[model samples]
Target chain A: GESVGLHLPTLSVQEGDNSIINCAYSNSASDYFIWYKQESGKGPQFIIDIRSNMDKRQGQRVTVLLNKTVKHLSLQIAATQPGDSAVYFCAEVISGSARQLTFGSGTQLTVLP
Target chain B: SQTIHQWPATLVQPVGSPLSLECTVEGTSNPNLYWYRQAAGRGLQLLFYSVGIGQISSEVPQNLSASRPQDRQFILSSKKLLLSDSGFYLCAWWSDEVYTFGSGTRLTVV
Candidate 1:
């Protein structure tokens, strides 16, 4: 009963440009959301997270925006670098007696110099 | 200050063979452990999770099974490998807001 998807499968951006990766979740009851970045041949790493009550949260050079009304979550990276080239995934934490996290199809971000 | 270790970075096993992947965590106690499988170009699918030692919750029913023998150890196994079981397996630990992951194991059941 949980589905999360991305608008695009891959995004190509030039170096130093700002990159925005979008995600749409179907579950509105999710209490928290997190964005993860996965590099080739490695496990995913946490980039940022946002609670359902808040609309936006900022970390070093990245930001997470949550729109509960539309069940949309987005990750914005400033000054995209070559090192930032990776697959990004958004996960929504369904809260209750059991903690279930639903992950969306990742968007592969390719930074071109 | 928590870290996870997953071994056998890559394995090529034949069908009908037994499978075992190990994951261990350090610097934390009683952390939540998870086993995830990722097929090519697909999102992570949660296979099993353990809240504590001997407390395992399975999300999906398949050829695989998980075990938590110790507080910081989680293992995923199967009696006989299947071709469908070949994929990238990831081990993770969650505490507080952040979830840290191990280097992952790539299993190829041929």
Candidate 2:
């Protein structure tokens, strides 16, 4: 089965520091990817997305970088805050597959004050 | 603006009880709808999806099923639930290459 997985299950960072989360996907046919943030007891919220055609995309204080060669994806958050503490997931979608997304196991991010 | 709505924010049922979870999309028509299940601290698993009314595609075979009765309404149902059925259920609508998920329903089958 094709799977998207995160390298780390947990991360801890200072409030003012940056945070980096990594994901590896097994589906080479995946053309679109998205990063989502999920708070406790809430649905996952879309944070950012990037198509395979682009290597990097930036949004607000977050950036998504994709490496097709290694089938790797990463999300970077700057100036992490308490509100930024949550589980993050990376999802991949194969183009023309009815836009069905395969999600990775989330990484718990704890921002220390 | 489009939004997805799922009902019964939380539910508790005994094993063998029936189940029905409803989801609807507002401000959008003829959109793709999906149902996903997530266990505690785990990734989402695609259960079913519908492209249009009366059209459904099941990604995995399970004890559950889904239906699209209207253009914007999707429903998930099970005749008899098992303890394994307990989890967080999410409904989503796809548009403009993005998926918007509902708040989700927390189901506990004891």
Candidate 3:
């Protein structure tokens, strides 16, 4: 099954610095994309989402960029805080349905002070 | 003010035992409900989804089944437990262009 995957399994960044997590999906039919943050012992929390029609969308201190040309997605967190350290996932859904979401393996972000 | 509620924070069941996990959504109606399972350090795996009462869609074939008797209620059940079934279970609801997830249920089949 073609699914979503992260380029890096783990990432380390200094506090206050920007962090970028990358994802590559193989499903061209995927038109809706979302970013989720999951802390240990908790369910996933939605951060931001972008539709295929748009290339970029920004929310709060987070930004999601989608590139349909390469089937790529990225999440950027500005001024990363200590609490920002967690596993980030990129999920995609095919057209006409937000019911079924395919999630990536996820990237673990570690913020260092 | 939509919220999702899942019962029994944790459970330990022996093999061959029956299992049932329930989830309910408040402050919403006719919402899309989904069931997901996550293993240690793994991504969310979609198990089942329901668009309305008595309408259940299975994503992956396993030892589990889902049912929705009402608009805001979803349930996961299994007749026999498999050790491989031990994992974290989460219920989610999509409504008003927003997605909300319950705290989650930790199941251990020993």
- The candidate scoring highest on DockQ is 2
Question: Model 2, residue A75: what's the lDDT?
Answer: 99
Separate DockQ for every predicted complex: 0.65, 0.84, 0.74
On a 0 to 100 scale, what is the lDDT of residue B83 in model 3?
99
Comparing 1 and 2 by lDDT, which wins?
Answer: 2
Candidate 2 C-alpha RMSD relative to the actual structure: 0.8
TM-score of 1: 0.96
Worst 10 residues of 2 chain A by lDDT: A92-101
For model 3, what is the error of residue B23's alpha carbon versus the real structure, in angstroms, after optimal superposition? Answer: 0.4
Q: Model 3 reaches what TM-score against the true structure?
A: 0.96
| Pairs in clash, predicted candidate 2 | none
lDDT of 2 by residue, B84-105 (tens): 9999999998887778999999
Interface CA RMSD, all predictions: 1.5, 1.0, 1.4
Best by lDDT: 2
Per-residue lDDT of model 3, residues A49-75, tens digit only: 998899999999999999999999999
Per-residue C-alpha lDDT of model 2 across residues A44-76, encoded as one tens digit per residue:
999999999999999999999999999999999
Q: How far in Å is the alpha carbon of B7 misplaced in model 3?
A: 1.4
Clashing pairs in 3: none
Residue A34 displacement in candidate 1 (angstroms)? 0.8
Fnat per model, in the order shown? 0.54, 0.83, 0.71
- Deviation from truth (RMSD, Å), model 3: 1.2
